[model samples]
Target: MAARAKREGVSPGELKGRLLAEGYAQRDHPGIVFRGPWHDRRAALAEGPDVWEVASRLRELDGPEEHRIAVLCEETALHPRHVRIAIDYAAEHLDEVLERIERNEEAAKRSRRAVQRRAALFAAVPDPGGRPRA
Candidate 1:
């Protein structure tokens, strides 16, 4: 364990925590996996969106719990079982999942702002060719 931790660049305790968490998820959550860089690890379906995405969408939905689950499954093309896995994982790690969602939202906002600024800058630039500005 110590040697593996050294190879992973994390302390033994931290490595143990990761191993236990992964083990528990494997045993209980089947198709779920913790992924991403160490700084931004998140739970995700094997070949689908992160659990937080599903959870956030599930929050936006209205109606009975069963109805919401049905709608989400249809919209995402995920099985009900997969959706339930995300919901259950989100319930267990609410703060972590919500924080990731918020961080993603902030990153998206920053990206949009950068794109707008770039577009405005390009618009202000005079054309290199001998054509009049539109």
Candidate 2:
């Protein structure tokens, strides 16, 4: 463990905690998987959205909890069990999950702005055929 931790550049205790968290997630939340680059590691459904997506949807929803879960399940086409797994995991790791969500949102906003800027630049360029853009 120490050698692995040294190689990973984390303390032995941090390594142990990571292993424990991964193991517990696998055992208790089979549908949930840790993914992304090391710096942006996050919990997500095996073949679906990140846990934060589920949690965020849950938060956006109104009405009773059960109703919100049902709506999320319907909207995402996920089973109740999968939705519950994400919700439960997010509850336990609220800070981490929320941070991930915030990061993703910021990334999405940046991407949208980049796309808009590129489009604007392209629109300003004269057509190769010498036709004016209307």
Candidate 3:
């Protein structure tokens, strides 16, 4: 049905409009068949791009902990004041900091795994005793 509609230069909305114009009505939701690109029909288009501009007031960050906080805060879209407050609040909460660290460790582990895999693949390729393969 969708292909036929498209070949005849029509979209789902156009087909739906024709049904309505012809006085055809469905009481239930008919299973929708996507006739266009999936991303093109996504809800994000209606909501627009998600962009949060965070300007950090703290120019200089002290210590490794403070440096990590500043970098992650800036990258994660948290405003300077909000990030500062959250970091300060989490400072006393050892559990939350540990949790964040655990997440970072997990990410590092994944990255290391990928690197090791690539290295192993490279190592598996034989040098062929320095003879060039034609």
Candidate 1 lDDT over residue span 1-134, tens digit each: 99988887889999899879877976787788988865567899887889999988888999988899999989989999888888888888899899988988899999999999998887777788955455
**lDDT tens readout by residue for model 2, 1-134:** 88988887888998789879888977887788988753567899887898998988888889998999999888979988888888888888899988878887899999999999998888887788887665
Regions of candidate 1 where Cα sits further than 4 Å from its true position: 129-134
Q: What are the candidates' C-alpha RMSDs?
A: 2.3, 2.9, 14.9
Which candidate wins on TM-score?
Answer: 1
lDDT digits (tens) for residues 11-128 of candidate 3: 8777667556323211121121122243222111112111111111222345565675568566665544455444443343346345545565688899999999988877776676
Candidate 2 regions with alpha-carbon error over 4 angstroms: 1-13, 24-31, 129-132
Candidate lDDT (C-alpha), each: 0.86, 0.85, 0.44
Q: Which of 2 and 3 is the better model by TM-score? A: 2
Using lDDT as the measure, the top candidate is 1
Please, what is the TM-score per model? 0.83, 0.75, 0.34
Model 2 pairs in collision? none
Worst 10 residues of 3 by lDDT: 42-51
Q: lDDT value for candidate 3? A: 0.44
Please give the lDDT score for candidate 1: 0.86
